[model samples]
Target chain A: MTGPDSSRIYTAALLIIGDEILSGRTQDANLAYLAKWLGVQGIRLKEVRVVSDDMAAIGDAVNALRTSYDYLFTTGGIGPTHDDITVDAIAAALGVPVIVHPDAQAILAGYYGDKLTDARLRMARTPQGASLIENPRTKAPGIRVGNIFIMAGVPAITQGMLAALDGVLPGGAPVLSRTIAAWTQESTVAATLGAVEKAHDGVQIGSYPFWRDGRTGANFVIRATDPAMLATVASALMAALQAIGIDPVDGEL
Target chain B: MTGPDSSRIYTAALLIIGDEILSGRTQDANLAYLAKWLGVQGIRLKEVRVVSDDMAAIGDAVNALRTSYDYLFTTGGIGPTHDDITVDAIAAALGVPVIVHPDAQAILAGYYGDKLTDARLRMARTPQGASLIENPRTKAPGIRVGNIFIMAGVPAITQGMLAALDGVLPGGAPVLSRTIAAWTQESTVAATLGAVEKAHDGVQIGSYPFWRDGRTGANFVIRATDPAMLATVASALMAALQAIGIDPVDGEL
Candidate 1:
């Protein structure tokens, strides 16, 4: 449990590797999923980097992020196609050679049976001395080298891999959040919100303005580790929003 | 005109500054919009970084990205709320003090008029010696310092700012793409696609796999600066798909 005097901070970084994302051909869905999942595990997602399939760019990003965070998760480029160069890129980044993991090969072989082709064999490759992250849905497993966890680009596969690794990582106290939405422009109640945040010592408030149903409003998300502090801040925020003549909704729009 | 020998690559990096995105409270719509918009202007969006509202993280990302790419575009954190710390962060990154730009102040004052409050005045602050990116829809303008373009986190405001900056930056030839979607697994025809890409000197192929209606398929996107080469690659890809007994769809599904 986190107290007022001491709190541990565990951070992670996500590196999304793909050319389709950069070209606007594919909308990325992995970052939000991974971030939310990490939050539940009591690890803060500190940063995210999206790089193309270029080997140099991938290598650079992996090297930069892996050392900086307690955990580094990467999505995409781990498929069987030609553009799937994440394993090679990560191998280069770690100054190691790409090798076929026996466990991964066994899993793929068992899944594909006699129909396993050379193209499918590509999925078994990983950086040397890496561990395999089990995929419940797909036979091809994700790779884990050092602090980096390499995952598939497909949202479903990424989710499955994340679920498999649940509770495996050491985490700190979980950060709790409560949202208060109001049908008023953020600028109109900005001063009041700022005062409420300043008055609260252990809470951080984030105001996200939105235009929904032809009306402008904002959602103030108050985050804190202490439940009592979060409750106090929530009440204070609700009062402030009401004092500004805007009815506060308990949740988001 | 882009020829085989003299094709120039103009690249950019986007810094998405917001905690909402990381917390999964907000789905980021800015990257795709900016990527597609930049493509029309013949600039490639190479990499993207999403950082929280923390000043150090924002400043570090800005400093790292601004010097590496031809241009750096940052969206989010430029609002009246307390979480909006992008301006101060950018100022710190550039080693300059945040000051109210006279022109920005004039615009905000004229827009807000008698209803202008201290919170609204915060929108006028920018780093010293930065130009303004006009936001026609909203009174508050975007900031531009050196090669960095700081725009609003809101999609509408960011779009307006990007539109106002149309044709302002120098660019190379636009990269054109033709997509051929086929109802077949990419791994089955990976070798043929790789061969076709190798035979074409100036063209590149990207395979994007999808699962639709409980069936697996992939889209082969052929990209090239030369129109002739792009057409040749697209035809070859279609023939290759047909050869593998898969019907090809002309465009994306």
Candidate 2:
């Protein structure tokens, strides 16, 4: 709840509400985007839960995450369809009545003009005393109630909603990262990588292995809140890999 | 836990452990593949939680999901690197000790031969009373402890582990799905879709909106365990879309 200058880390959790995702009918494109966007805001994405469109499931996850993280974001189930029950579910989770925000209804009315129907108006419903997150691409605005920000599932629309909230929430120092890749199996240099990470304070290194062009390799990502520490760790990792006769690339191979 | 023949739905939850995924540095490729694979086994992937590589995070998620679902599957953090603490974390969560499986050690020893290092042997570690989920491509096998199936982070390795697990778990009836796409805004047919779902029993429909080639459209997915009901709902949906003056395609456009 404090400002970005307070030097405390801010965290968030994402709840992806959709049966299509759970059914494997759709591959999620929102998690990576939200993670990167939150990182720029100086908030780390701590966790993510992908649940179905079931009301109780959404409500339970929303209640759990909204209490645990600094911010809780939900994507999907906010459209004008029968399956879009995000508003109703979140309201139930918050123990508040669902109300149609006057401004949201007005925006939908203006957007639809003479063709506005009851189903279309469903987009204006939100939890009591909620505000709107502007959807620049689509007329249906996203809802922001308590610590929860409900946005559309579509990547582009979620982007617009994120753009609307840019620099609005207070965040801590942005986490910085540097990558060093090598043309060797990760197991070959696991010990040195662990030792390097333990040698540095407030620095964490992640090893991601890949198989490309019939060869196995890995990329080491060093992260720290301070840029100087990140660079030092990255350099040390490169040296360590080179010591093992593995040529380390500056970035991903 | 009842078997698949008991006329009850079987469910599973997935726990994705990795810092790279939460840091926005890597996109998760395992969830969708696992979801589809579980579907074929007639086990529903009810929920998914993506947590960081921290021990406590992994342990807490494993405890939560393992109890809530019939089975819990975890991907990532099962490698030979320092960051790979999934075995230790899971062992702690289960209130058990981490032990090196002799069979896993023998397999790794046989595959790596003289090149086997301590780091490589770290892949043989698992929670107490755990069994191996064979990785046909890589010598490092997956770990299965109680209801938890610990797998590799790489897509290919995870596939091999799933293949080893084929027909091993008890599952309910396989969920079937039918998709209907129309080049019209979903709001136009929201009322009809909701009504049709209400009129049918044991059927659920999901509406996913999309914008392509500068045109608005949506795909309505109908899912049901019974093939007859699925077909009936699909026909009703197509007829409803036709009544609304929108031509619907049988599958996704």
Among these predictions, the greatest TM-score belongs to 2
- Expressed as tens digits, the lDDT of each residue in A163-200 for candidate 2 is 99998898998898888898899899999999999999
lDDT of 1 by residue, A128-194 (tens): 9999999997668999988899999999999999999998887887789998888887889999998
Model 2, span B118-237: residue lDDT tens: 999999999989999999988799998999999999989999999998888998888999899999998999998999899999999889898989999998889999999999999998
For model 1, report the TM-score of its A chain. 0.93
Q: Candidate 1: which stretches are off by over 4 Å?
A: A1-6, A242-247, B1-6, B241-249
Q: How many backbone clashes are present in model 2?
A: 0
DockQ per candidate, 2 decimals: 0.76, 0.87
Which residue ranges in model 2 land beyond 4 Å of their true spot? A1-3, B1-6
TM-score between candidate 2 and the true structure: 0.97
Which candidate should be chosen as best, given lDDT against the real structure? 2
Query: Which residue window of length 10 is worst by lDDT in model 1 chain A?
Result: A1-10
Q: What TM-score fits each model?
A: 0.94, 0.97
